[model samples]
Target: MSVVITQVFNGFSLGSILLFVAIGLAVTFGLMGVINMAHGELIMVGAYMTYVVQQIFAKYAPQSMGYYFFIAIPVAFFVSALLGWGLEKILIRHLYHRPLDSLLATWGVSLILQQIARTIFGAPNVAVLPPEWLDGGVRIAGVVFPYKRLFILVFVILSIFALYIYLTKTPAGRRIRAVTLNRDMASCLGISTRKVDAYAFAIGSGFAGLAGCALTLLGPIGPTIGTYYIVDAFMVVILGGVGKLIGTVLGAFGIGLVSTLMEYSTSATMAKVMMFALIIAFLQWKPSGLVSVKTRSLD
Candidate 1:
């Protein structure tokens, strides 16, 4: 029973990581309908930013290094958000209705970003040391739960709650949803669809950065770190349902739990293969995904 409980907790922790990575992606791909191949690069950028922040603290304020993570989070978000805003204004804005072109352009951007990271940070992986407070685990009922993992779970919950509040309570968020539901109608009603797109893209990119920051607690990060998780992020969004927050949450936990259990029972490679096969079969039955988003169509 203790082992089972531990495994379940581990599954939730894994699910939290996936949810963290995919939440931003859901906003970008689901709401905007753009296949942003460069989204992972943005995550890389965030991780780099966190490293940079850590270095700054280590060099200038070693005494306060333990609290550097709190500062790094916002810094990563803004840096990535700024880059996303610029990308939207300069390139993505022109390719709004053109998915293929957007994909190609973003793919090129991802390559460029990866190369830039290599040039700046070298090709080797870099490690970010966790704070002293998060160095150990707590034991409950003979089961150990790591503090880092617990932090991630809590962070994901707070992020989702904040997002829910923003989307449901704020005027800017309402504008974003309105544009998403019916771009033409939103525009007709005097909402600046283009501006909403930019805002939404930046917000999504910012969330990706937050995920990157959280990742530092897990392992060493490299220029290609984002590439490792991008596909999984996309899978979560697709399996959940485009433009559906609740679905994204459910899909992330569902995959995480199933994948962890499969890995425990079998091999990692087989687990992945089995998971993919299951997803394929599930999609065949429900093409729209777990929760379908209903949008207003002019046609």
Candidate 2:
């Protein structure tokens, strides 16, 4: 029972990371129908950004390791947002309404970004050492859970909560939702669809970057590391209804728990195979997703 609880916590941590990563893809793809294969690359950029921040801090402010994580959070947001903005302006903007084309274009962009990262950071994997404060585990009823993983789970919950509040409470978020539901109707109602697209992409990319920062806590990072995440993110997005935050959360936890349990019973490869098969079965039952979004046509 203790082992199960420990694995459950571990699964929650993994799910949290996946939730952060998939939320962006869910928002962008669900809202705009633009398949962003480069989404993971944006996440890779965040990990690299964290690495760079670590190097700088270690060299100049070794005593302030704890503060560096705090600083990296916003830095990751901005760097990834900036890159997302550029991608929106350069590539994604033109590819809207053409998901297949967007997929191909974004894949190309991902390759380019990967090559650039390799050139800059080299092909070798880089480790992201957590601060001393986050090095230990906390015990609860004889079950030990790593502080780093717990922190990530907390962060993910908070982030999702904030996103939910923003989506439900803010005027800008309403406009984004309006546009997402019906772009033509939103335009007719004087909403600037293009601006919404830009904002959506930026927010999505920022979340992806944040996911990358969280992932560094678990293991080493490399240029292609995002590839590992993209599959799971897609699975989450597909399992959850696109553009539905609540669905994203549920999907993350559901997949996370099931996958963790399967891994315990079988090898990692077989676990993955079983998970994918289950996803296929689930999709067959609910072709749209577990939670489908309701929309109204302006006409």
Segments in model 1 whose C-alpha atoms lie over 4 Å from true places: 294-299
Q: Summarize candidate 1's per-residue lDDT along 51-121 as a digit string, tens digits.
A: 99999999999999999999999999999999999999998999988999999999999999999999999
Pairs of residues clashing in candidate 1: none
Instruction: For candidate 2, write residues 1-299 as lDDT tens digits.
Output: 89989899878877888887887787777666678999899889988888889989999999887778888888887899889988998889998778889899999999999999999999999998877788989899899888988889898888788777877899988988898877899999998888888987888888888888887888899999888888889889889887788888999988988889899999989999999999999999998887996768557
Cα lDDT computed for each candidate against the true fold: 0.92, 0.86
Compute each candidate's TM-score over C-alphas.
Answer: 0.97, 0.96
Give model 2's TM-score versus the native structure: 0.96
Give me the displacement of residue 50 in model 2, in angstroms.
Answer: 0.8
Model 1 local distance difference test score: 0.92
Task: Find the candidate with the highest TM-score and give its number.
Answer: 1
Candidate 2 clash figure, as a count: 0
